[model samples]
Target: MIGQILINGLLNGFVYALVAVGLSLTWGVMDIVNFAHGEFLLWGMYAAFWIWSLVGLDPLISLPIIVVLIFALGVLTYLIVIRRVLKVSGLTALLATFGLSMVLKNLTQFFWTANYKNITNPLVSNKSFKVLGMYIRQDYVVAAVGALLLTMLVMAFMNKTKTGVAIKATSMNKQAAQLMGIDTSRIYAITFGLSGACVGAAAALMASFTPIYPEACALYSTLAFVIVALGGFGNIKGALYAGLIIGVAEALGGYLIGTSYKYLVVFLIYLIVIQIRPRGLFGW
Candidate 1:
């Protein structure tokens, strides 16, 4: 019984982690907190919906298209809006992002309306597998596995590859790295684009569990903020760990208390953590 809750929590948490890590990648690399991150995820879900509807591609399978589109969007945003603001203080950057967030949100609502939306597929409804007595639906399984694989891939790239090394270098010390012949500008562009690509995957995973609504962009935006705060800013590993923690907390809170009070506990923890150690558990 306990194991089932844990597994269920973990699967849910991986989705949150994917979202947080994408946000953190930008923050860690460029000190940019993209308030528009969740909106990117929202748009990707819509993108997946259309592709699936028109071409009969499953949302899972249409992931590449969603990713490419969002990635391009991220790159364009960097070049057009974010590039000029990068040198300012964090508050200024956040203000720009917040404005962008509102713009994207209103744009989505304008085009799509505020009605609820969902996608159907075999994997989402299919009876899949049982792991540790937890009913592992196919969508959950695929999302978890995808999240894990991507996390490992990013970690491996950062740990072993040349460009990845450059990214890490830029993240840690931009000026020193620029002196070493690394194209800091290009690194920032790729980092934001990669983060946006990850947001696409997050959107696809979210479609399996929840309806896509205009408010989803803001709701998940707050959730991502909570997870990032809970886990610690600019800490990918911490975000992963924090996701499971928040997921478990939310699951247990909903089960033991009420669903309405779930975020209370999540945010309470966030406040405590941020108050005591603002840098975060793993923040560097």
Candidate 2:
């Protein structure tokens, strides 16, 4: 039972990490608290759903398209909306994203209604395999693996490439990066796009097993924000580790206490961690 709980928690953590890392990256570079980040995930889910429904493509096979589409949307958002607010007060920026969030959510509802939707015949849906006396859902395993790969790829992109270095430099000190001839605007756009892509990948994986709806992103988004705070805002690596921790905590808490109290346990951990380290587990 313990092992099973651990496995479930760990797998869930990978998905949470995938959701949080994008927010961390955007925060790291632009210092923008994007309230609309979850909408990107929602759109990605719809993209997968429609592609499957209309084109007969599997979510797994359509992942790249979803990523690209979301990336484009992110870049466009930066160019059109976020850029206009860059020079304004932080509160204005926050409100701008908050507005965007509401608009996206409402638009989705207007178009699709509030009905819950799911892939009826996803390739990995409802499949399970037994391992070490525990049955694990195949969709969860696949999503976990996909999330891990995406996280590693993002890490490598930030750590190894020249553009990645420039992004890191920009995040550390935008003025210094500008002095060094890095186009700050371009970097910001790229960061948002990359963030969108990360969320897109997560959405595709999640859509395989989870239901979809106009407001479906709400719970996941709230959890992602919590993960980002617990991990340390602007710290991608921290978010990764924190996500795993939260996942395990939620699983254990749900099993030991009650499913209804799972989030209570998570927030309690967050409160304790913040008291000990105000900047998060790794904010510096």
Candidate 2 local lDDT, 1-284, one digit each (tens):
98899889999999999999998888766788889999999999999999999998988999999999999988987898899899987588888889999998999999988988888888887677899998798889999999999999998999999888999999889899999999999999999999999999999999978789988889788888888888888788888899899999999999999999988899999999999988899888
**TM-score per candidate, in order?**
0.92, 0.97
Residue 82 of model 2, lDDT score = 93
Report the number of the highest-lDDT candidate.
Answer: 2
TM-score of 2: 0.97
Model 1: worst 10 consecutive residues (lDDT sum): 119-128
TM-score of 1: 0.92
Task: Report the CA-based lDDT of candidate 2 relative to the real structure.
Answer: 0.90
lDDT of 1 by residue, 1-284 (tens): 66666677788788888888888888777788899998999999988877877888877888778889999988887887788888876588778888988899899999999888777653566565876566766777788888877766777777799988998889889999999999898888888888898888888766756788888767667777777777777677788888888888887777677879987877887888888888776665
Q: For model 2, how big is the CA root-mean-square deviation?
A: 1.0
Residue 199 CA error for candidate 1 (Å)? Answer: 0.7
